[model samples]
Target: MTSLPVIDIDPFGTEVLTDPYPLERALLDAGPLSYLSAHGIYAVARYDAVYAALRNWQGFQSGAGVGLSNFRTEKPWRQLSIVVEADPPHHDAPRRVLANLLGPRAQRRLRAEWMAKAHKMVGKVLDGTPGSTVEFDAVTAIAEKFPPRAVGDALGLPEEGRENLLPFSDFLLNAFGPRNELVAAGAPHAKFLTTWVMEHCRRDALTEDGLGGQIWAAADRGEITHEQAPGVVRSLFAAGFNTTVHALAAVMHALVTHPEQWARLRAEPSLARIAFDEAVRWASPVQTFFRTAVGDVPVGDHVVPDGAKVLMFLGAANRDPRRWADPEKFDLSRDPSGHVGFGFGLHQCVGQNLARLEAECLITALAERVETLELAAPGERRLNNTLRAWHSIPVRARLA
Candidate 1:
C-alpha cells in the first residue's frame, strides 16, 4: 500500500481549537487519511472515512484510550471510562446496562416533566427583563442555566455544588486533547472535581426514582457488579450535561443567525425536533475523538498502523460536501437524521436521546414564546479541545 500523506498542521493548537473548519477542509482535501506531522498521528476528516472508522471498532479500538495519550502506552491521568473507552466483552455489559437505563422508556418518563420545567425556566428568564423585548446572554441565561439544573436534578445531585459540573466537564473535554496549557490550567482543580463526582455516584447520594438510582438497581439485579455501578454513574455524569448544554446553545445560535429559519420555527413550533438535529449537524458540539488502531486499518488507499492514534474529525465530517448538499447553509428543511454530530456506530453517544429531549423542550418553549430571535451583540466562542461552545450569546427576544 502507498504511504499516508503527511500534513504539517497543529490540530490541537489554539487557532484550530477556536476555528477548525479551515484545517478540517485541508485534512479532507489532502487524502482519505493524512499524518499530522505536528502530533505524529493519522487524521480522517471526510464523512465516509470517519463513519468507517467508528463502525469498524474492532480494527480501531477505544479501549486503549480515546485521547492523545494511549492508555496502553502511557498511564492515563484518571481512570478510563468503562462505557466510552472500552471494547467488546469488557464494553458489552456496561453499554447494555446504561443503554437500558437511558433508553426510550426512561426519556419518555422524563419528557413531560422536563417540558414543564422548560416553560417555567423560560418564563422566569423573560419575566426578569424590563419590557416585551428582553435582552440577555443566551449562553449563560438560557443554554447554560437549563441543562445542569435539569440533568443534575435527574441525577439527584445536591444543588449547592452543582455549579462545579461545567468546569469539570470543560476540564474533561480539554484532557482529550494534547497535554497543553488548557489541560495544565485545569490540573489544579482535578482533585476537587474528581472527589465531588465520585461522592455523587454512590447509591446513598441518589434519589430513589432518578436515573443514577436506576443504574444501581441494575447492579442489584446482577446485570452489572456493585463495583461497576459508580463507574457507570460517572459515565452518565461525564457524558450527559455538557454536550446538551453546548448543543442547545449551538441550535439557538443557528436559529437567531438565520432569521428565516427562526421565523419558520416560530410559525410551526413542532419543527423544534428537526431544527435541533439540523443544528447538531450544522455546529457539531463534540468535535474530535481519537481511536487507537488495534491492527493495520486500511482507508481508501492507505493503512493506519497498529497502535497508532487516529483522530476522527466529527465537525468536519458533518459538513463534508460529499455527504451533504449546500452543507454550509443552516437550513431547517433538510433531513439531518444520519449526521455523525452525536457520533456513529456502537459508541454513538448513548445519551443522545436525553440531549434531543432537552433541546426539543427548550427550543419549543422559545418558539412558543418568542416572535423573533435576533442577536443583540457579537457572540463569542468558548474554545475547548472537544466541545464547540459559546462563551456568550447576547440576544433580543421579542415576545409573541
Candidate 2:
C-alpha cells in the first residue's frame, strides 16, 4: 500500500472552515489523494479520484450517508436523504419520483413562469436603487424568495407555510455539518421543518397545485406508499431550496468581482445559462461530500480500509489543474458541465435542471437591466463544513 500524504484540517480553526480552497489546492498539488486526520477523514482532492468515488457507488456506498460519517453507523440529524444519501435499488425510487416532478417537460412549464417572476423580482430590486449602493445579499434575499414558493407551489404546500422555506431550508442544509453553534442555532427551525413535512404527508395539508399534492396523488395509486410521500416533500425543502439560493449568491459574487466577465455577460445575455455553470465550477457551493468505503479500496496507489470515510472535495476537483486548463480562471467559454459541482453518475443532483433554470432566469434578468454591476464593499465568505458561500456582498449597479 502506498503511504498517503497527511494534512491536518482542524475544524476548530477558522482558517480551514472559512477558506478551505487554498488547503484544497495545496492537497491536490501534493497528490490526487491524501489523508487528513484533523478533519478525521481520507481526502480525495483531484478530479480523477473524486469522479471515481462518485461513479463507483458500490465501492463507496451512499447508504452510509454523504456527510462525515456513515448514516448506518452514526445517525444523521434527520433520517437519511432518500435522493442525496441513498444507494441503488433503495435510492432509485425517490430519485424517479423527483425526476418526474422536475423532468424536462415540467421544467419547460416552469421556465416562462420563473423567468417572469425573476424579472418582476429584479425590477423591484433594481428600482430606486440605481447608482445607490445596495447589498447584493439583498439580491440573494430577493432571489431566495422564488425557489421555495415555486417548489412549495409545485409541492402543494400552502401559501401560509411559504415563510418557513428559507429558515427551515437553512437548518436542513446546516445540519449536514458537525454539531456546532451553527447547527444548534438552527434547531427550532429544523424541528419545525420536520413537523411540517411529516404532517403535510398526512393527506390534509397538500393543495392541488404543488407536487406535495402530487405525491399524495401517487400514494393513492400505490406508486408511492403513504409512508414515502411526505419524505419526498421534505426532500424538496431540504435539498431543493438551499442549494439554489447559495448558488445564485455565488454567481452574483463572481459577476460583481469580475467586471470583464460581467461586461461579456451584459453584451451576450444569452450566455446566462453558462455563467451559472461556471459559477458552480468556480465557487462550488456544494463543496464536499463524504463516501464510506464498502471494502478495502485501492484508489491512485493508496488503499483505504473497509468502512473508512472518503471525502470527495468537489470544490478542489472543479479547480484541479490536471483536468481543467487555467483552472482558477473563470472563463465563460469553458465547458463546465463535466465538473462535479453536481456530483456525478447515479447520485448527481436530481434538481440540477430546476436550479439551472432558476439561476438562468435571475442572471439574465440582472444582465439585461444592469449596465454595470460592481462590488460596493469587500465580500465575506461564510464557512460551513460542506458549503462554500458568500455571506455579504454589497454592490453598486448602474441600471439601464
Candidate 3:
C-alpha cells in the first residue's frame, strides 16, 4: 500500500504564521493537495484544488463545520453558528434574517454612522501629526474598536463589563484548533464568552433600536426561538470584531508598502470598495476552514476517502497561480469579486457586506486625509494556525 504523504504544520511558530512562506513553498512543491499529519487533515493548498474545494461545496459540504473538525461528528466548543456551519435547507432562514439586516439598505443607513466613527478614530490617531510615528497596529486596535462598540450598542448590551467581547471573540475563534498553546491560552477565558453574550440578550440589557432588538423582533415574529436569540447576537459580535480588524490592518499594510497604489487610492477615493476586496484577496484574514468529506471523492490526482477532513487553505488559494496571475503580488486592478476571501457557496460569510463597509470607511478616510503613506519601520506578522494578523506596522504619514 502506498502511504499518503504526511506534512506537519507548526501551529505555534510565529515565523510560520506571520510569513507563511515555508508552508506556501512546500504546498506549491507538493502539488495541489497534500495530507497534513499535524492536524490529521488533508489540505488543498495550491490554487486549483483550493478553488475546486471552495466551489464544489456539494461534494465538500459545510455541514461538517468550518473549523478543524466536523461539528456533526464532534461538538463545537460553543454552539454552531448558523452562518459558518450550516448546510442549505437548515441554513436558509438565519441566512436570510442576517442578510436583510446587512443588505444595501442597511449599508446605506449605517454608512454615515460607521463612516463618522471611522473618521473620529483616524482623526484621533493622527491628531496633530504629519510626520510623527504612530504604530500602524494602533490603527488596527482603534479601527477594530468600532465594531465591538457599535455592535454592542446595537445589541443593547448593558454597561456591565462589556469590554470582554473582543477578548472572548478572539479566544473562541482560537478554540477551533486542537489543544495547543493557543487553545490552552484561550481555554481559561471561555466563560467570558458565555457571560458577555448572555448578559446582552437579557430584556433589561437591550438597546431599543439596536440589532439585538432586531434579533428579538425576529424571535417575536417566530423566525427564531427565544432561546436562540443570544446565540445570534453572539455570532454577530464574534464574527464582526476580529475579522474586520484583521481586514482593516491588511489594507493598511498594503497601502503602506505600495506608494503608487496609495497615490491611486488618494486620487480616486471611490476605489475604496474595490481596494478592500483586493486587500482581502491579497491577505486573507482567516487562513483555513475545515470541511469533512461526506464520501470518497477525487480531488486532483488524489482520492480522499470518506470521513476525511479537508483543510481549505484560503490564503494559498487566494494567491493560486491557476486562478491569479502573479498570484503572490498584491494588485489592485484585479477583480477579486469571486475570490474566496469571504468564502464561497452556502457557507459564505454573512457579515461580508458589513466588513466591506467598515473597510471602505477607514480606507477612504485615510486616502482623503493622508497626503502620503510609507513604512516607518519593518512590518511584523502575528502567526496563528488560522488567523493572518500583524503585531506592529510602524507608519509615517503626511496630512492631505
Candidate 4:
C-alpha cells in the first residue's frame, strides 16, 4: 500500500492565500490524500476524493465540527452550527426546515422584489455621463451593498446595525482555521457582533413575514421541537449573511476580469445564473472545511484513522484539471453542476438557493445596463484563514 505524502506547509499562510491556484494544482498532484505536517491534518485536493468524502457522512462526520478545531475534544469558541456541525438525528430538523423554506419554490416573492432592487441599485451606481465609462469598486458599490438590502431584509432583520454583518462574518469564518493574524484582525468586533447576532435573532426582534418567522412557525407546528427553534434561526442568519456577499464579489470580479465572459452574459441575460455558478467554480468563496474521520476510512491505497481531521480543499477541488476542462479559465461554456464550491451531500450549504437567487438578480440587472465590464485597477485580496474574499475590486463599466 502507498503511504500518504507528508507536506510541510501552512495551507493558510499569507503567501498561499494571496494566490492559491499554483498550489491548488500541486496539491491535486500530490496524490489522492496527503498529510499536512504544519497543521497535523490530512488533506485531499482531487475532485473525486473530496466529493466522495463529502457524500459519506457516516465515514467523515460533521458532528465533530467542520473546522480545524475538533469539537469532540476542544470546546468551540462559538455555538456549534446545527446545520454544518452535526449528523443524522440532530441534523435532520434544521436541514429539512431550511431546505423547504429557502428553496426556489419558497423564493417566488423575493425573486421579483430583489430583481427590482438590483436594477435600482445598479442604476444608481452606473449613473454617469452617457456613452462614458463609470469607474467604481464593484466590491464596495454592489457586493457590500446588495446582500444586506436583499437577504437581510428577507430575514426580517433590523437594518440599523446591518453594517456589522460583514465584520461579524469575518470572525465566524476565520475561527474555522488556526488562531493567526487573520483571526486577530477580526477580534475587536467579536464581542459586539456576537451580542448583536444574539439580540436580533430572537423571535421578538424579527417580523412575522420573514424567513426567521417561518422557522419559528415550523416549531409551532411541531415539525421541530420548540427548543430547536432559536438555534435554527441563528444558523440561518449565520450561514446566510456574508457568504452571499463574497460570492457576489467573486462573480462580479470574474465577469470584469474576463471581457469575453461579460459579453456572453450581456448577450444572454438568462445566463446570469450559469455565470454565477461558473464564478463559484473559478473562485471559491468558502475555501476549506474540515470533517472528522469516523473510523478507518480507506481511499485508493491509504487509510485515515479514526478522529483524524480531514481538510477538504473546496477551492482546490473545484479547479482540478481532472474534473474541469481549461479549469483555470473563467469560461461560461463549461458546466459547473457538480462543483463542490457550495459543498456536497447532506452537508451542502442550506442557503445555496438563496445565494443563487441573489446572484441571478444582481448579475441579470448588470447584464441589462452595462455594455462592457473591465477592471478599473488591480483589486486587493482580503486574506482569511477560511474564506477567499476581496477587499476591493475597482471596475470600469460602460453604460448601454
Q: Rate the local accuracy (lDDT) of all candidates.
A: 0.89, 0.78, 0.74, 0.87
Question: 1 or 4: which has the higher lDDT?
Answer: 1
Ranking by lDDT: 1, 4, 2, 3
User: What local lDDT does model 4 show for residue 187?
Assistant: 85
Model 2 C-alpha lDDT per residue in residues 1-400, reported as the tens digit of each score? 5567888765324686787767887878768678887766788889988898888888988788777656767656567776677778877777787788788988989888888888988887777545554444533555467677566666667787677776776666666666677777778567667777667666688876567777677767777667777777667777787677778888888888889999999889998989999999998988887888998988888888888888888889999989999988888988888999988988788889989998888888888788887788787776566777667777878876
For residue 345, what is the lDDT in candidate 4? 94
lDDT (Cα, tens digit) per residue for candidate 4, span 1-400: 6667888878888888888777677789898899998989999889999999999999999999888898888877767877788899899988899888888776787889999999999989999766788998888899989988998889888879889878887788888888889888888888989889878777888888798888889989987887887788878667776788889999999998889888988888888889999989889998998999998898658988899999999999999989899898898888888899999999898788889999999998888788998887899988887789989999988888
Using all chains and alpha carbons, the TM-scores for the candidates as numbered come to 0.98, 0.93, 0.91, 0.98
Please give the lDDT score at residue 288 for candidate 2. 80
Counted clashes in each candidate structure: 0, 7, 1, 0
Error of 3 at 199 (Å): 2.5
Model 4 lDDT on a 0 to 1 scale: 0.87
Per-residue alpha-carbon lDDT of model 1 for 307-348, expressed as tens digits? 999999999999999999999889988999889998899899
Index of the highest-lDDT prediction: 1
Candidate 3 TM-score, true structure as reference: 0.91
